[model samples]
Target: MKTNRLKKSLLGITLSVSLFVSISIMGAPQAAHAATANTTTTAASTSVSGKAGSIIALGKNYLGVRYNFGAQKGVTSSFDCSSFTQYVYGKNGISLPRSSQAQSQVGSYVPRNQLQPGDLVFFYSPIHHVGIYIGNGKIMHTYGSPGVTISDMNSGWWSTHYKTARRVIK
Candidate 1:
């Protein structure tokens, strides 16, 4: 009888330990998955910001370039609004459609207040113009007269004509 009780006790102890280990093993992958997802998100955000900075830097290199209504692609001498965005973003591995209307349809929509650098901001009712948000309420784009320039988005024609914005990064 004593031997039987000892065997029962040992069996119970072994079952308990097995259950605990099973639970721990099952939970480990879920915890690791959560941690991995968080790390990936952070890394992706950092990479997007870096790319945005590079695109803006490249755009700035053409700050005063002439504007042509139907500017030729791959030609840097003059740029229409969409051409400017296409050229700059293309240089950094992001491809934008040739027309502002088409570019607006590519990325996810972003609220006006949540605009970030490198976001494509559009103007006009049907989206006639496109610009690169350069932070601080300013956008870099090419237009009549000044050609390529930075304009305030808060209080001017830009503000009134603001239609929508899109985020292409990530």
Candidate 2:
């Protein structure tokens, strides 16, 4: 009788331990999967941040370039509004259309207040001009007067002509 009780008790303990082990094994994969997903997300975010930084740096470097109508596509000596935007982003591995109107349609629409460092900002009633946002409500563009210059978004001309902004970097 004692032996029978001992055998039953041992069987119960074995079963409990087996169940605990099975549960742990099942949970381990889920935990690992969650960790892998987090790692991938972090990596993707870092890549995007790096791209944005590159765009801003390019914009800053080309701040003094002159504006030219129908400027050469690959050269930086002169640029139209769209060409200026394209050149800045293109240097960072992002390709934009040759015209401002077309570039406006390429990215997710961003509200004016949420503009980031490398956002493409549009302007004018006919959507004829675009610029690169450089934070602090300032934008860098190749305007007729200043060539490539930084202007406040609230400036007389820009404030009236401001249309929308778009975020191309993902």
Candidate 3:
């Protein structure tokens, strides 16, 4: 009886520690998100709700950050194309593979017309690039010249180079 009681006590302690760690990790992002937020209505605030608002809201904060090739994951210092998308979505509790090509395989395909906010958009010949669709036929991404910013999805090179779109949020 004593041995069984001790085991139960240990299990209880273990669970408490686990829950504490989880809460700590999760709370950090919520705090940062709330800190940076203004009155913007993200995909999370529209007719749909989930990770979109939180994801886009955070992505907006990175605007004007210069592009860096092969940026290390989790580093907000500078971001590459895939790293930008990965970081934004990752904050919302969604894990994506490191590369744009690999990240493309994680979500379900959606036609361009059906894309809503929080949708992942792919581009280029071999699908080596990606961005988050923020509705209104625009995408927020980092590449070449400008860092994190929005672009017209139907304008110029994007329209001709668009490959596919994926719905990562549901």
Candidate 4:
């Protein structure tokens, strides 16, 4: 009788320990999952903030480089209208196509009134010219008088040739 009782008692203890371990194993992952989620949220937020700051910094850095014709491929000293836009955004970690026409195809279409910093403001009928929106109804581009300068959207030249604006940044 004692032996049978001892066996039952041992079995009960072993079963209880197994259940406890199982519950702990399952519960541990939930805590870990919560921690992982928190980490991911923080990383995403930091990445977005970093990107916005980088874009603005890039815009400020390449303010006055001269415009070059057919100069969209490499990071040369001077930049054409399209090249200037590509270089500024590229420096901010965004890769754009070589031509303004090509770059315009990507991202959401932004209306003139909705323009923001880092947005690509396109111009000309054939879509040959492009510039970076620098807020306040002004765009930064290479004009004949100044290589890279800010001009109002309502400026006579830009107003006539204004095609579209696109937002490539998230």
Candidate 5:
């Protein structure tokens, strides 16, 4: 039984790697920091709803996990802000940079009102934190106590330090 599970896991990983390699070869690699000067942008109406929902669903599954600052990437045990976003999005076949600052430069910017599920919402100046916007102004992110919980974007610290949002699922 264990050997069968191992074979299945290996097969799945091989397929995923093949797809990722093919996609990477077909597209030019762009620096995630290239859009730093632009900072925030306002765009709407192009994101695919299905992808966003899948991303959010994956993120929601991590609720109650502890927040470990500087957690190792790809580890399911615990997650830092960026690593959390990276893993959740990666599970849905999207690649995100490893830091909040670089991630803040991703995708076309969307205004707060225009944010949809799966949009990456950033917080604080210089981009110290990130969360997956799960619609209705709530964000699913890991931080401090009650890790990975969904919180309102319009209230408390998140509201005060609201920086910008990126539509990475587009």
Candidate 6:
């Protein structure tokens, strides 16, 4: 009985050591890879967000510039929604098309819930207007009275007019 008990005890210890060794060898690399992957993802997101901030900052410089229905591109005195986005993004080395409809087709389509700052948000059923999302559900855009101003995207007129969003930076 004593010898059998001793053998069982030895077997249990051997199994435990084997498990520990396997986990230490195999699990270590996987854990390390996961950590590295997480770091890479965070870094990429930070870089993208930083670019977004720069774009937003540039756009805000033209606040109250005045809105024009057919405002020419590269004009700073007055801007239509599409021209404002094109000019601001162009200044940051990101080229956007001349019109809002054309601009919408250039970037990756991003859902409203996944919108980030600097995203080009479009409105109207067939897509007529565009704005740059400035986070907190607000967009910086040019309209009738508030040219190059920030407005909430989640309430009032904007809420019902929400159409789609696009990510041009990434």
Q: Candidate order by lDDT, highest to lowest?
A: 3, 1, 6, 5, 2, 4
- Candidate 6: residue 13 Cα off by (Å): 93
How far does residue 165 in candidate 6 sit from its true spot (Å)?
0.4
Q: What local distance difference test score does each model get?
A: 0.81, 0.75, 0.82, 0.68, 0.76, 0.79
Local accuracy of candidate 6 as per-residue lDDT tens digits, 1-170: 99999999999999889778745754454344334422212212332235576667667667788999999987677899999999878876799999889988988999889987879999998999999988778788999987889888999999899999999896
Candidate 2 pairs with clashing backbones: none
Clashing pairs in 5: none
lDDT score for residue 57 of model 5? 50
What TM-score would every model get versus the actual structure? 0.71, 0.69, 0.74, 0.64, 0.71, 0.71
Off by over 4 Å in 4: 1-53
Q: In candidate 5, which residue ranges exceed 4 Å CA deviation? A: 1-49
The root-mean-square deviation over C-alpha atoms between each candidate and the true structure, in angstroms, is 22.1, 22.8, 10.4, 21.6, 10.7, 22.7
Candidate 2 regions with alpha-carbon error over 4 angstroms: 1-49
Q: How many residue pairs clash (N, CA or C atoms closer than 3 angstroms) in each of the candidate models, in the order given? A: 0, 0, 1, 1, 0, 0
The candidate maximizing TM-score is: 3
The regions of model 1 sitting more than 4 angstroms off are: 1-49
lDDT of 6 at 48: 29
Error of 1 at 43 (Å): 27
Give Cα distance to truth, residue 115, candidate 5, Å.
0.6
**Model 3 TM-score (2 dp):** 0.74
Q: On a 0 to 100 scale, what is the lDDT of residue 44 in model 6?
A: 21
Give, for candidate 1, the lowest lDDT window spanning 10 residues. 37-46
